[model samples]
Target: MSEQIEDRNVARAGRLDTATLSDAMDRLGIVGQCRAIKPRDAGFRMAGRAFTILYGPAASPPGTVGDFIDDVPPGHVIVLDNGGRTDATVWGDIMTEIAHRRGIAGTVIDGINRDVHLCLSLGYPVFSRDNWMRTGKDRVQVEATNVPVNIGDVRVAPSDILRGDADGLVSIPRGHEERILAAAEEIEAAENAIRKAVAGGMRLDEARAQYRYHQLQTRAEGAKP
Candidate 1:
């Protein structure tokens, strides 16, 4: 995508919540809803392109955990895939402090993270299966960076836009971002209209029917959403 288009879409996505985007993905027959992964703090929010990192078991004499932080661009989320290991944490307070200072959008881990207080205090979003204090240093090593990785059963590639909120996180594939954004905007508009209609005392059923709410996310078989 061109820089201008990416900027516009990212800005638009920043204004939306994960719920609406999930609905859009459903309508478009795309699977972007991340399951199980949740925000460290309920108030935390983030939207940014992904900078993926993959992790795997360490070998004898174990490799270094990583020195990849400095390479991430601002406004890009750090995605760490540890194959859902909860016994060790791939992130901690130090990473959070640096990421926050560097303007990194947030960090999403397929495993767990330590130092919850620092992340919460810094107001930096960190989404993962859960949090714990055990370090992943020697247990896992950086397998690769900027490669495709899985999160909550969904495959996320580099540059995929991730939006996290109180509910959870949802990813927008770079290939289908434009269509998903447009669909999500449409869904949001209709929902907003429903709220206004109800506020004006219109019957709930009538408002839904008038706005085609029932079919908004119903995928049309074999057609693009």
Candidate 2:
């Protein structure tokens, strides 16, 4: 029975599309929207499940935020939900190194992060609202790991499909990964056909009309004369 549960979890995580993940982010209206770090050198491509970390102001002691970094697993992104505070830094240089060494996919914070140069130099992916040199202990702490966390009005659970690029970051609910991916693939195909039509000397208006780019109007009109 335990094995079956484990298998089910694995199957669920694997439902996401490796290629269409980014595209889905774009189609779903969640892409390239993260605030870029100064001297922007932080970005990476990773495929795996998500491991979330929750945070709060009174969550931990002073000078000990690194302790939370120890709990992350390999092939998982350390998503930190710091209640959207842009004042303190929840991530830093040492923490970045440790996370990378542990095979962590990346780090996403709903707050500020420090050590921008170090993280970028290490080729570790980090997504946050802003960057700063302030330490986390002064204003933030890791309250829990692999738990639900609120990020920008969204509650993210562990093992969700997280795909982000220069555009922005997005969390795809685990159960909806397969369906969303299938939808994104179909959307891509439809757009590609439209592009080909335009490239074949068809006027922009003609292409748009041929593809019914305004499908809404057709639906509404079908109910009329």
Candidate 3:
């Protein structure tokens, strides 16, 4: 993606919530919602490009887990894919402290996290399947970075836009960001119009009809919203 396009999409994405994005993906026939992945705190929210990390079972000799935080760019959310393992944690207090100090946007793990108190106290967002106390040091090892990985059942690629909130996380593919954002904006606008109409005493059915509410999330031909 061009720098200009990325900036534009990122800015637009910041204004959107996961609910709208998920509806947009549905309309576009894209599966972007990360199932079962939720924010640790209901009030936590984050939006940024993705810095992906893939983790796998540790080697027989127990290879190093990883020390990739130093390389993660500020304002990018660290996305860890541990194959949805919840027994051990790949993130901890020290990493949270450094990530917060470095201006990192947030962290999303398909597996789990430890030392969540640091995240809460620092006001840093950490979204994942769950939180556990066991460390993953010798249980798992970093397999790759900036590569495609699965979070829930969604595919997340490097640089993909991630918008996470109390609801959950949604990974917006870089190539489809523009279309997805446009669709979400349209959906939001329609919903707002419906709300306004209803508030003005119009019948709910009439308001929905005026906004084509039923068709708002219906998949269109050519997958164009």
Candidate 4:
């Protein structure tokens, strides 16, 4: 059952954009949108299962910052929760190069990242609260891995589907992925039909009316579509 679900999630991750997924989440009353977290480059896009990491203040000796990259599986997103600290960076050029070479999907941070030029040049997606030159090496340490973490204001668990594009990133809970994907697919189809109608000379209002645009993301009782 778990395998089947994972497969479904992979399929959804490949096809859905963050906007549609956000709508689906809203319809389902799920708060998966990561506020204030955005791509280092607006052109960068990524989709993958999350490999979560939680961060905390460094101990007296100052623990390591990014050794976890070596163990992350390919196609898994590295979600770093740095407590929304923008003063220090949890990622940089070397990590970008390594993550790109390893086929890792991308990195999303609640803090900031330095050396973003490398990511832009290499096309390795890195999303964060902001970018800075300050190093997080001795300021923060890995608290845990494959653990539940907060990004923006959303709670993300290990293996949750993460989708990011020009707009921003959103985390879809694994358990609700199937339902969310279904609603997103429906919403996309409706929007497409509206677009088609508009292209075929129908008024924008008429097209939206025909497609019931306002209700596409309306929250339903019990989270039913």
Note the clash tally of each candidate: 0, 6, 0, 0
Could you tell me which residue pairs clash in candidate 4? none
Show model 3 residue runs off by greater than 4 Å. none
Give per-residue CA lDDT, model 2, range 155-178, as digits (tens).
678877666555456566665655
What are the candidates' C-alpha RMSDs? Answer: 1.2, 6.1, 1.5, 1.7
Ordered from best to worst TM-score, the candidate numbers read 1, 3, 4, 2
> Which residues of candidate 2, in runs, are more than 4 Å off?
1-47, 59-63, 215-225
Candidate 2 lDDT score relative to the true structure: 0.63
Worst 10 residues of 3 by lDDT: 216-225
Q: Write the per-residue lDDT of candidate 1 for residues 27-100, one digit (tens) a residue.
A: 88999998999998999999999999999998888986778999999999999999999999989988899999
Q: Give the TM-score of candidate 1.
A: 0.98
TM-score of 3: 0.96
Candidates in order have lDDT scores of 0.93, 0.63, 0.93, 0.91
Query: Model 4, 73-138: lDDT tens per residue?
Result: 998899999999988889999999999999999999999999978999999999999999999988
TM-score of each: 0.98, 0.74, 0.96, 0.95
Leading candidate by TM-score? 1
